[model samples]
Target chain A: AQRVTQPEKLLSVFKGAPVELKCNYSYSGSPELFWYVQYSRQRLQLLLRHISRESIKGFTADLNKGETSFHLKKPFAQEEDSAMYYCALSFTYGSQGNLIFGKGTKLSVKP
Target chain B: DAMVIQNPRYQVTQFGKPVTLSCSQTLNHNVMYWYQQKSSQAPKLLFHYYDKDFNNEADTPDNFQSRRPNTSFCFLDIRSPGLGDAAMYLCATSSHRESYEQYFGPGTRLTVT
Candidate 1:
């Protein structure tokens, strides 16, 4: 079956510390991957996508095909960075845009 | 600015009562989706409408139904509310051909009592 997995339920870190949130997927065909974040009392929003190969808010995610991983990384974490992060995968069907998401990881950046 | 919108940011429903959640988008995207998310869990896809075509996920329960009567609006209907169905109902929209970044609406938090 096609699935995304974020192993850590919660990751707490001090401000200015480096942080990494791991995400792995299981799929047979090529799939588009995305990292979404939800801040408290805010809507879930797109953080970044693997295809873009770009960084947002000092965060970057590298898609490692050999290991089937697309872990989100930030060299220095900030208190405002605390939020719920979800890893999602989308595949091209005949004409539908279906996304399968993993149980998210909650990151708490302490001051 | 173009964005997705969900009405009634919070909803309260009695057990066995029916509730409807509405969403609208001005992005002119061809695909719209509804997802159910509980505390600390992944957002589960309930269904989506690609243009005028409706697609439902296999595991989605029959009690959860959706309607996209037009290009700009979609509705999620819960036939009979149960305590377990209380969750954040998220509505998202993206381009038709590709599942690019989906623009999400401020979700509606449904509370069942």
Candidate 2:
């Protein structure tokens, strides 16, 4: 069974505070991990991917194969950063077109 | 420019009534997908079309069906929507196969009355 898990349904942080959204996965084989964000009244879009190892909009996600975790992190949070973030895992095979997404975490950055 | 477009941003349908949601893409992608997302829940894959070949999820109910008449358009038909069928139907497109990056459309919120 392949599944993605985001432990926190909501995370609130003060402006300029550090923010971390945890995500974990369970899969027998190697998987591709992704983080997607959706703003209010906006469509969901890709924020970053584990393979790229790059930061997007001051956000970065590290993939730990040993722990099966791909947690998204940002050193300083901003009010505009508040949105619904989803962690997804892609199966390397067997209907590769589909991505298994977690329930998602809603982040709120207050001033 | 919107790569994907879903019409009728909000839809209301009576219980046991059939409803159709339409989606069109301008990216000329070969693969299109339909997902059902409820409030505070993850989006569940209903089905997808890869160049006219429809692939249905094992757990998808028969009430939910999809059609891709061409590469640019797709439709999701709910034969008889139930109360639980109310959700946000999302349409997504990818340029190629097995790609992690997907462009999503403004979802259609379906309300079952």
Candidate 3:
């Protein structure tokens, strides 16, 4: 069974401060991790994936195989960055397109 | 623009009544998925269609059903709505059935009364 755990339910930070959202996964096979974001009055969209290794909106996540973690980080947070972030894991074997998501973390960037 | 679209942004259904949620995509993706997201919880996969092939989760209740008439459209049918069934139902599409980046719709909020 593939499982994703997001430790924080709510994270508050001041504008221009660094922010990190923790995520951990438990999967036997090679996992494909992704970060999805949902802003107020917006649909859930893919922020980035471990395979892409590309930063989106100044946010980046590194997948650590040894620690089984994929933490999302941003050097400087903006007030518009306030949103709900979800970490997801995917297994290619049986459930191909289905994503196992973690309970989302609500990020509040105060100005 | 190529995107996933879900109909009826909000739905109100009576308990024990059947409700259907529709999803369409202009992306022409081969895979479409349905997910149930409860308040403060992650979106859980209910089922998916890979080029017309239906795959349902093992633990998904029998009350839930799905239909894929074609590549661009899919529907989720809830045979009997319950209080617990009230949640945000999300529809997503991807180009492939593997680990491709998925495009999600603005989810349909279902409220059972």
* Candidate 2 chain B worst ten-residue window by lDDT: B94-103
lDDT of 2 by residue, A33-109 (tens): 99999999899999998888999999999999999999999999999999999999888543444788999999999
lDDT of 1 by residue, A15-110 (tens): 999999999999988878889999998888989988888999999999898999999999999999999999998876434557788999999999
Candidate 2 residue lDDT tens string, B26-85: 888888999999998999989988788899999999999998889999999999999999
- Model 3: which docking level applies? medium
- TM-scores for all predictions: 0.94, 0.96, 0.96
iRMS per model, in Å, is 2.2, 2.3, 2.2
Least accurate stretch of 10 residues (summed lDDT) in model 1 chain A? A90-99
Candidate 3 structure quality by residue, lDDT tens digits, A24-58: 99999988899999999999999998888999999
Q: Model 3, residue A59: displacement in angstroms? A: 0.9
Instruction: Report the candidate with higher lDDT, 2 versus 3.
Output: 3
Off by over 4 Å in 1: A93-96, B97-99
Off by over 4 Å in 2: A93-96, B97-100
Report the lDDT of model 2 for residue B48.
86
